[model samples]
Target: MSDRNDIDPFYDDRSDPVRVLVVDEAERGERLATGLEAETDRIAADTVPTVDAALEAVDRRPIECLVSTVHGPDGTGDELLAAIRDRYPAIPVVLVVPDEERAREAIDSGASDVVVAESVSERCFVLANRITTAADRYRADRRADRQRRRFREVTDAVPDCLWIVDPEWSELSFVSGYERIWDRTAAELTGTPEDFLNAVHPDDRERVRAAMDRLSDGTSVDLEYRIRRDDDLAWVRTRGEPIVDDGSVVRLVVLTRDVTDRKERERTLSALHSAAREIGSADEPAAVYETLIRTADRVLEFDYVAVDIKRDGYLVQEASTLDLKDGGYYERTSLENDDTFAVRSYKRQETILVDDLREFDVTPADPDYRSALTVPIGEFGTFQTGASEVGAFDRDDREFAELLVGHARVKLAQLQDKRVLRERTEQLERQNDRLDEFVRVVSHDLRNPVNVAKGHLSIAREQYDDDSLEATMEALERIETLIEDLLTLAREGEEIDDLEPVDLATLVPECWRYIDTKDAALEVETDRTIAADRNRLRQLLENLIGNAIEHGGSDVTITVGDLPEENGFYVADDGTGFANGEREKVFDPGYSTGVDGTGLGLDIVRRIADAHGWDVRATESDAGGARFEIVGVE
Candidate 1:
């Protein structure tokens, strides 16, 4: 007999010829071996003289079938059969006997088949058939056993529960992972296959039963249902397929997988999506923080949840769950405090999950909490959840908390931007008011003294006609002009309150007439009408035309044309264009190249353009002159 370990369970021996051992006296055994081998190509026989020699041969090699005479040299064939049966039960034995009585005794002693010695010479084919058939059947049985073991091993390693039952649901033919998944033993479900349904949640039992019925009726079923084990409920997705034989349902094959974690994740995401919408609509930082705290409480189901916002170098608790608020756990920690969980998470800009606060040296905001999960809300602050039980939070809880905090972080940033814009606008308004008051004061206080001086100059001019008196009059006029320009800048350049359609063709000619142009040519090439303050437009046109006349000499040609591609207009003059590096500085207040220029003309033009939400730039025109192009017109 071969050792069990020496056999290759997966090996198939049916394709190879069967090796047979014949045990008898020398001449008889040799004759039997010869006869068996001559009968068929499938049987290879070996002759052994005695029972002891036959046993040795069987042990030495893989012998599929054994053939022995009723009388051997060392022992009776019955003794050999008994020994083989005890040691190598898988091997089939054939006994060669003299008559029917001996054949019956061999059959009773567990011989696979018996052959009569009287017919042995002529019935070699019959003996050959018996030997080959016995060997093939034995190999097939071994293959079937191996397949069963392999199936069990594979099914056991899988996480999903696999089960099979008859169509009538009377017997459970196979079950794997039943105990670990259902929290029950296989024996409980063996006799009563329907007993497994008792572990299903009461609300889902009817649905599970209906699915089973559908499977029995040859209809495949895929369903998700909850199963209860003690006080806990788990979600399981089950898929059942009916095994059909000749168009009739014979058995049901079901694969059930635990989906509790997946279902929980789906629920958490759905809740977070809704929470994000709410948080996004909040116009204030406090409201966003409140929403985050509520979402953490509802989704994570933590014992306590809180939101801390960074204010004045401190993390100030703004919102918290009711339990935390009632317990006076609203803590205020400085940004530099490394001992606090919220501050630590905020400083690190990462999520901190502590399974047991006692294991860490850091101090928790609430000492009663044994576990905590703290997530930073960008640079704004921190969001933390705590529980009284140790190791209450898992990876999923941390991920969900981060998602909620992320939404809050975006909302906080938006609110901060709006607050900054509002403050800046208010500051600009106050500055504009003070500028208006200053302009009025300077216009009033300086104008009275100038009027007195002009009156005194008029008296002096009547008394004596001289160059000094005339120069004094011109200097007084220049100072008055400077004051008037300053007043225009302070009053009209702030913002345009009312805008009416002003024809550039009509306004351009009117502004040209107002400017003291000695001989400059005015060409209004555009008939475009634009929305603007008419007075400011006139002032802008006057400034450009006067500047061109002053710099380009008296006979310079000034062209006002539509910048169709830029959606605005340009004022170009065929004059000496701006010097190198002077284009950018031309619009600055008090920037001038002309000796007697007030330098506020171009600055006023830029301010008016900005008020109308237009962009103005100075560039060299095609006519080799300065060009002021204003774009982004409405």
Candidate 2:
């Protein structure tokens, strides 16, 4: 026999032919090889004389099958069969014997076939058929074995966990890459269907079971669900096909993939997009809060949402998705500790998470509420979310929640800045209109006084009279007053940049000296200190006092008193009060009831109050006098 072991057994075409070992007497083996050529054109035979030569031939070449006589020169055919079966089971053996007893013995010894050969020529055809059949089968078996090994090699390199199971799912037939990917051996996971299903996450097992139940023969199933490993949770995408036999389901081949990373990334992206759409388009803080809570419930599925803002040193519930009647307030100082999650989050300027609310220092309003996450919105407030299940929030949930809070904070900041810009723009527009009016009034008022003075001077120069000269001097004084008022009005349009604590008692008395109070009685009911521009506030007081003395009589009692709730201060008089309809109009530029008074005094008071970010409004005093209250003094 020729040594052909270096040759590949699985040739692509018939040119390479199947290799066969013929073990018998030299003449018989030569006849058998010739007959095999006649029987099949794709087989090549090599003759060996004994079991020893046959074994050596098999090791030296890719022998597909063996044909030998029951009696050979070196050994019996049964012994040759034993040697081939022991060392090369994949090589099928065909035995030829001289009688029925030998054929029976050869058949009993596990030969592929036993042929009784009364004459060598007659048995040639039978021997040829047996060798060809055995060789073909051996070739096919080798091809299949190679394919299975190739498949295993490829599957072991991939992340997908491939498995094959019996129809009833009682046992796993095969598994690939389980040990590498799942950090568990295949033996550990191979078991009944219930054993495998038990490894699925409790919350997701029922759905997986339902999907499995719906599967039928010839059907393929695909699904995604969470599963519990030994120590952690993982997301898996499973795909399976049923192996059908005789039109019935026999087995299931499933492929499961660890898709935790992919699922997490997808969830994060979906949550961010949802939050962006919800908070980005909101027009106001209320709308933003509403969208934030609704999106939080939808995205994170939290049980409740609440936002608390610091107002006047008190933590007031700005917005809440919780149904509570008294969403009133909490003392800001009292909750500024670790006792409250919201307070701790706000003071520390960090996010706080509690997996079990019962373990927290503070008492939960809802005993069923188990977990909570609180994040600070800078110095603005605290945003809180609650969950009804223990361990509901994980690090991923915390990260996503913090991202949502960050988006909310940015959106809210934009909204607030937009509102402030709109308010300042409107204020600038109003000031522009007032300045236009001031310019027109100055033009009209100054022209008349100047024209009168010029005409009176001409008359005085021509006639040399005391009355004309006096009239010119009075007209000049009026022009001086108008110019001074215009200068003050121009200066009041600017915002107050510097502020210091001012005592109302001292400032009010000082302003009284600057204004012509006449015999007007001054009453300082309260002595409070407020942050204000000292010079601008003094001008405001002077104008209010002047208006009271001018509109009322010279003896009008001007009373400066504190407003209710410590909100601000009020200036009033015990003179003839304003008519109900005229109170609001009295603050308009160029509006005065008195004949000798310029209408700009009360308007200047309003402008000055606006510059200091104070709210000034006209109302009735206790003495039934005109009252101007300036609130928002802080």
Candidate 3:
């Protein structure tokens, strides 16, 4: 029989005719090599009668892969493996051994892989690729030692933890720096990284374990989560890069790092940014203050937050989004000699962040509140209607209470100003409505009488054949017509709907029929539909088209067309377009820049559109007249 530790006894492949160097005892090795060549045209075999020739070819020549015996007549294969490793360290050396013990020795001697001939084909390809790749890596590694060192240093410089594992989630090796990973001492996690995770708070263990499994399956993972510490919980990250052997995952390593501070800052900044937007958009002072309370809680809700709206000189806590809701904020306050932090803050209109309110100025005689932050709402310089308070607290919360309060100051001022302005606007709008209604009714009633009188005078002048009387009647008729147009414009706001979806297709044509088109041309163009209140939309289009007619020259054209160009829609007219400076003012009740017209027509158009959440703007149209565009809607 061939030397027991020669190359594979069975022929594995017959393609691309492999040239294999078989190292074994002289006589039996030649027999097997000869048999292998005769068995298949796919294999071309060569025999090296001693370990010496095997070592020489492996060291000096370019061989695709190697097949050598671990237990030769001389000894075990370590000497041969060592020789190959010294010269071509990257070349993977596959040892043919009869037993696992020999295989182990072969591997330790720097064979890239090991296999037994009894099942050699089951693993020949595997061993062959390993030897080839290991040899190549060995050569490159020797050449690029400096680059490898720099690469290692750079990888270490990255703040995140890195790791490697197998598809089975078994750890191969964590980096050397894994010891100092968390709040735990290195002694606490000396053996395995899993043990460190085992010490994690029970709540986070399952999730962390799951994340580890996902990482093992060749996934790029980015996650934010809490990691338990000895005393408290801290946020951490577990990240990894997969190492694939033979195009399949052989091992994976992962890194973990603490990110508590950065995550907390992000949360705070996000809350502040959100609060800023909410404050800017809030129409009601209460709604804006509500956003403030929510933001304070978002930062440190566990600490306690109280929102007070001062009424009748009493600090009435209107709402609280606290960690412990319904609890008395009194116990959380620092009141020294009857002056509480909340009171002082409200009185001075200043922001105070208290780490321990009860301990501040506390001598048993002056036990003030502890761990409280007071943000005052004194903007509008005259909420004089009352004072307000929104406070936050937490144990490990970031020291962002004042920053939050800083965010609050500008927004509160804006909200309060908005509130006051809204109230005054309501008052002014009411007075103007009253004045417009008064104008409408008086004008409507006076207009008809004037027209009737003008008609009778015209008839009398015609019957009496008096040219002077005819001129007087004609002047009166003209006056009557002007008054009637004013009355119609005033009454535009009279009938708005109770809010329902109005089909623009149905509404535009109806308005065109009702409006006074006696002096101007009107056209309705519809392509798509709009959801709006029925009568209100009709009125909006009515006033707009009527004004186009009233202000436009003799060939006046009112084109009610959908604005495909505008994000929403509009009505453009070929008349004298509204003047640039007075466009915005055109919506105000008494401000009209049109010739011989009451300005309320376009104002009615704007108010009705605003109530429906549509924006109306005036621009010059290609139609050689004014264009009112409603933009930014779906």
Each candidate's root-mean-square deviation in Å?
A: 4.9, 19.2, 17.0
Between candidates 1 and 3, the lDDT winner: 1
Higher TM-score: candidate 1 or 2? 1
Write candidate 3's Cα lDDT for 423-533 as tens digits. Answer: 999998998888777796667667767778877886787689887887787677667655654555555545444555556666777777886677666666765666666
The TM-score that candidate 1 achieves is 0.81
Instruction: For candidate 1, give the lDDT of residue 369.
Output: 84
How many backbone collisions does model 1 have?
0
Cα deviation at 187, candidate 1, in Å, is 2.1
lDDT of each: 0.86, 0.79, 0.61
State which candidate has the highest lDDT: 1
- What RMSD does model 1 have? 4.9
Arrange candidates by lDDT, descending.
1, 2, 3
Q: Write the per-residue lDDT of candidate 2 for residues 375-480, one digit (tens) a residue.
A: 8877678888888898888887778777877888898899889999999999989988988887777767666767777776776768775775776677677776
**What would the per-residue lDDT of candidate 1 be over residues 83-141, giving only the tens digit for each residue?**
99988888999887878998999999999998886756767888899899898898787
Model 1 weakest lDDT span, ten residues long? 1-10
**In model 3, where do residues sit more than 4 Å from their true spots?**
1-174, 186-225, 245-250, 269-283, 308-350, 354-368, 378-634
